[model samples]
Target: MRFMVMVKATGYFEAGIRAGKEHSAAKDAFLHDLQDAGVFQSAEELLPSSSGLRVVFPPGGGAPAMQAGPFLPEQEWIADYTVIDVDTEDEALKWVLRMPLPPGQGEHVIEVRRLASGTACALDARAQTMKADLQDQLSLLHP
Candidate 1:
């Protein structure tokens, strides 16, 4: 199973100021361990939401409205994330629990969600059977 571990926090354009570069060593060590275990796929740090844009779609279908960040509700900010392939959710949680904390960061909120890899990856037998049936119907529609 592949899990996406996200680190969520509320901060401004200056999240790095208090986070401190000194913690990079600890972060690097954690990454090294993940790589050594052959579970790490990738990791990334997201920039402030102010650099993003939001598209709001109207009901029933119409032109969408575009709004630029910084968005409100600071609680929605996700600072960074990592993708890892593990045997089970418990194993993934074990790894996430060891993730190093950013300097000056108080409590961190992390979210772990399994990726929908493919028909054969994480889907149950029933889901796979349904997907196969759907594909058969779609093929007939085009042919």
Candidate 2:
């Protein structure tokens, strides 16, 4: 199973304050532990919302709309995420418990969610089409 562990954003993150050395070291150590355990797949911190964009689709089949960000409701914003492949949810939870808190925090939140895999859903057709299209594009670039 694959799980995504997301760190929620705060006003401090929006201000672009970097993580303190101690906090960074702690996080690095945690990541190293995950890698050593053979569960870590990927992890990264996101840029603030000011540098991101949101795409909104219309109710019908009209064109999609794009909005530049600085999106509010800090609780809804994501600061960073880690992806891990583990045997079960319990194992994933154990890994999350070891994650370090954000630097200089008042309160912070982390969310964990399981990801869908393989062709086990109603959207499998669409997903396969997109995958084939991507492969075709990549082949064109390489050839």
Candidate 3:
């Protein structure tokens, strides 16, 4: 099973306070361990929501509306994410429990969600094709 583990954002993170060396080291070590165990697939830390935007589709079917960010209610933002291939939800939970706490001494939340896999449905196939086309376009730009 594949799981997406998301580290929730806090007020401190929204303010752009980066992880301290100790916290970074701890996280690096933990990720290294997961990699060594062949469980880690990918991981990344996201920039604050201030650098992002939101596209909301209206129910009445006009056009998607864009909302610039510096979005409030910090709890709604995600700080980072990790993708891991694990045997079971219990295993994923165990790995999540092993993650280091965020720099400041306060409450933190991590969400783990299973990723869908196997044979693609019609919508999935369309999405996959779109993703491949986008990747090809990106390669042209970068390469």
Candidate 4:
């Protein structure tokens, strides 16, 4: 199974602060283990929400609007993530437990999510036709 392990953003994360050297070393070792096990696919850190943007799509096929961020309450943001192709959820959890967090954050959260492959869902005939049409439209934009 493939899983994405997400490190939730805290205030420090939004401020672009990271954990200490000891934590980093431990994390490095943990990443090395995951790589050696051949489960590691990619790891990345996201910029703070303050530096990001949101695209809001209105109801009933209305035009989308763009909004800049520094969005509130921090908890809704992700700071970093790792994608792994592991054997089971249990194995993924074990790896997650080994990841170190920035100390003194009061409360820290990590989330694990299973991603859907092949356009994220099983497509019916109509859905497949919709996808092809969407792609055809996009190709017109690019080509």
- Global lDDT of each candidate: 0.81, 0.87, 0.87, 0.84
Please give, for residues 1-143, the per-residue lDDT of candidate 3 as tens digits.
Answer: 98999998887888998768899999999999999999987889998899999998999899999988878773389999998989999999999999997656467989999988953242435678999999999999999
- Give Cα distance to truth, residue 32, candidate 4, Å: 0.9
Instruction: Report the C-alpha lDDT of model 4 over 1-143, residue by residue, as the tens digit.
Output: 88999988988878877778987888888889999998887788899999999998998988899988878873388888998888889999999998887677657889999866654443446778999999999999999
Clashing pairs in 3: none
How well does each candidate superpose onto the true structure, as a TM-score? 0.75, 0.79, 0.80, 0.77
Per-residue lDDT tens digits of candidate 2, residues 1-143? 98989998888888898778889999999999999998887889999999999998999789999999888763388999998989999999999888998756668888999988863343345677998999999999999
Candidate 1 vs 2: which has more TM-score: 2
Question: For residues 1-143, what per-residue lDDT tens digits would candidate 1 score against the true structure?
Answer: 88899988556322434455667888889999999999987889888777778899999999999999777755477778998989999999999999988755456788999988763355546778999999999999998
Q: lDDT winner among the candidates?
A: 3
Worst 10 residues of 4 by lDDT: 116-125
Error of 2 at 107 (Å): 1.4
lDDT of 3: 0.87
Off by over 4 Å in 1: 12-18, 119-143
Better of 1 and 4 by lDDT: 4
